[model samples]
Target: MLALNKIRPGVNGLAVIEREVREPGPGEMLVRVHAAGVCGTDMQLYHGAGAFAQRLKLPTTLGHEMCGTVIALGPEAATPQGAGRVKVGDLVSLESHIPCWNCNACRTGRAHVCPNTRYPGIDIDGCFAQYITVPTSIAWVNPPGTAPKLAALLEPLGIAVHATLEGRGVSGQTVVVNGCGPIGLMNVAVARHFGARRVIAIDPNAKRRQMALQMGADEALDPTAAPPVQTVRDLTHGELAGVVFEYTGSPDGVRNTFAMVGALGDVRWCATPGQPMDFDFGAWRKSRPTIYNIHGRRLWDTWDVAAPLVYENHIDLQPIASHEIPLADSPRAFALILAGEAIKPLILCE
Candidate 1:
């Protein structure tokens, strides 16, 4: 079977290579890849930025947000506390973070931050191939009739669901999304669906700004065009934003976030700020806003929160995907994302 394996450690190292599919290990299941969503993390790793650059082993298949059907299972594939079980023919989305259930973090109800964690695409072979193996425990079976693209997005959608659901109600509140990348746009849609009064989208890119508007943002601003902080203040009638979703991960975006958000507002961050941010603590002391650094969706808990909305068709995510490419053309897909010409590129792997 062919896989989009990262042949080396730099952006240029990414390429599509062939590999043999191995049988699933004990307590694991073999999933035939269907569709996968490319994320910003993949871009960072491709550029050899962040800690994942050091952790990533070369020549590993690189993707985690994916959907597929189970074709085979290893011995005693799953142990259930309830009725849920892993079986062949189940259509599922995988949990990217694979934790050691025996770790103290896992034992104490913090498995999401397990000490010895192995993340698919980063730490191990991931689902960018015809067949990949994973622990059956992390597979989430979707409700029937879910479309191929929608199933592939469940993993990333859980991110928006987690951030929005975790925050205090956005009902009738003005919200700001300081980036209109895929997840940032998802934040806009989720906020609108959950009932925010006004959702503002911020990004320098015109295309993404347009996407933000389509995804339910009341206003989309180019931070470079208009003095963003002042514009946001004026647009909000001086009330400022009640909640700011920081998705740019740029230091400028971080700096402006504190300015655009109102006193006591919440800044729920979901982007990766590569370097140490020079946070304006002096000005921040006056507002006393609550800050949340969102890690990956709160494990199975977020799945329970997001699955119903997705299955019932409350949130539409099809717009976030700007490019659809074959898995064999992953290098081209990666180039598109890295060049900032695309948002989420949905990859199909048969």
Candidate 2:
């Protein structure tokens, strides 16, 4: 099997090379990967930064968001939960977070933020290859005829769903998505579908701002051209946004996100910054907004809601999948993202 691996440290250390496929271990499944999406975490590894970057053992396959077919399952592969059962021919989308099932978080129904969580492409070998061997616990079986490319998007789409379903639920409220990245653009559509009164998207890139509008945002503002805080305030008629989804990890963007929220609103913080930045608690105290730190999706709960939106075609995801590249030429996918030419590029593993 051929896999895309981070063979060295520092920036741009990826290589596509041949490797023997490993058989599934006990309670694991061997999957024939069809398509995998390059995401922000993969970019972090490409730059050799952050906590996840430090945990990498060299020559690890670098993707987590993927759709694949089940080829074989090892002994005791059945899930104890009695749902999401996987058969030999099932198409599946992965939950990137591999939580320790014995933790208090898992037992108490908060497994999404389990302290002992391990991620694919970071803590273990991931799905950017012809064949991937993984624990069956993280796989979500799709309908028999799910499109491989769209099924590949379920994992990331789950993030947008999780954020939209957070505090206050986006219904009948003015919402602002402070970044127009892949996940942010998805949030724009999700917010609209969930009955948001108005959706405003903010980004410096004109292409993304335009994409945001196409995805259902009522307004898209270039943060570089005009101050986002004032623009959102003016657009909201000085009431400000009732809910602000923060996806930009930059210092300025973070500050603007706080400023754009109405008093007693909800700020769903989704993005993780590469470095720490200063924040004003005084300003935060004045707004008194409820802050929810969103991580990955709620195990099965988020998947149940997210999959249907895609399955039923309630929210169009065609615009988010900007490009597709073959697994052998997977390096170009990362390059396209770095150059800001593609939103989410799928590496076709099959």
Candidate 3:
């Protein structure tokens, strides 16, 4: 098997190397990966910073957003928790978060925020390889004829869906997506499909702003050219947005998110900054908006809503998958993202 591994610490220490394939362990499944996507978490590992980077054991494969076919299952894979769940020949998209189902959070249906959660790309060998062995509990089986590349996107799309469906929902509200990254752009489309009265997108990147318009944002603003907070306020006729999604993790962007929302509005804080930064609780108190800290998708609950949007063609993800590179040339995908030239790049593993 050929895998993309973080062979060394610090920036850009990735290499594609040949390795012997490992068989699945008890309650696990072996998958032949068809496609994978590079995400923000992978970028943190690439830079050798953040908590995820600190948790990495060197020479680990670095991917979790993927779609693959089941080739084999380990002993007891069909017994206990996974009984009658996944099986050979099923096409599946990974859930990314490997939670300890015995924990309080998992036992009470809050597994997405399980304190003992482990991530594939950061904790164990990941799907950047031709084959990956993962616990069968995390696989979401796709319809037999579903497109593998699009299925690979479902994991991220789940985040957008979860945000859109959070407190107060988007229907009939003036929504603002304060960043135009892959997930943010997905939120723009999702907000529109769920009946948002108006959707506004904000990003400094010209290309992203243009893509936001394509994804159903009524207007896209370049924050660098004009202040997004005032622009959003003016566009809303002084009412401000009813909901604001915070995807830009910068300090300035965070402050602007608070200022852009109307009093008593919902603020879905999706992205995490790499380091600690100052914040003003006084301003937040004055704004009186409720802040929702979004983590990964809400396990099966989110998948149920997200997967259908893609499978039924209710939202178009084609534009977000801006580039595709072969598995051997996967490093270039990271380069494209770093250069701000690609939205979401798919690695063709098959």
In terms of lDDT, which candidate is strongest?
Answer: 3
lDDT for each residue of candidate 1 in 145-232, tens digit (9 for 90 to 100): 7787788888888888888876685888999989888888888998999999999999999889999999999999998987889998
Off by over 4 Å in 1: 80-84
Give per-residue CA lDDT, model 3, range 1-350, as digits (tens). 89999999999999998977789989999999999999999999999998899899999999999999999999879755577689899999999999998999999999999999999889999999999999998999999999999999999999999999999999999999999999999999999999999999999999999999999999999999989888898998999999999999999899899999999999999989877889889988987999998999997899999999989999999898999999899999999999999999999998
TM-score of each: 0.96, 0.98, 0.99
C-alpha RMSD of candidate 2: 1.1
Ranking by TM-score: 3, 2, 1
Off by over 4 Å in 3: none
Per-model lDDT: 0.85, 0.92, 0.94
Candidate 2 regions exceeding 4 Å error are 79-84
lDDT of 2 at 134: 86
Checking candidate 1 for backbone clashes, the offending pairs are: none
Q: After superposition, how far is residue 186 of candidate 3 from its true place, in Å?
A: 0.6
Report the candidate with higher TM-score, 1 versus 2.
2
Find the 10 residues in a row with the least total lDDT in model 1: 75-84
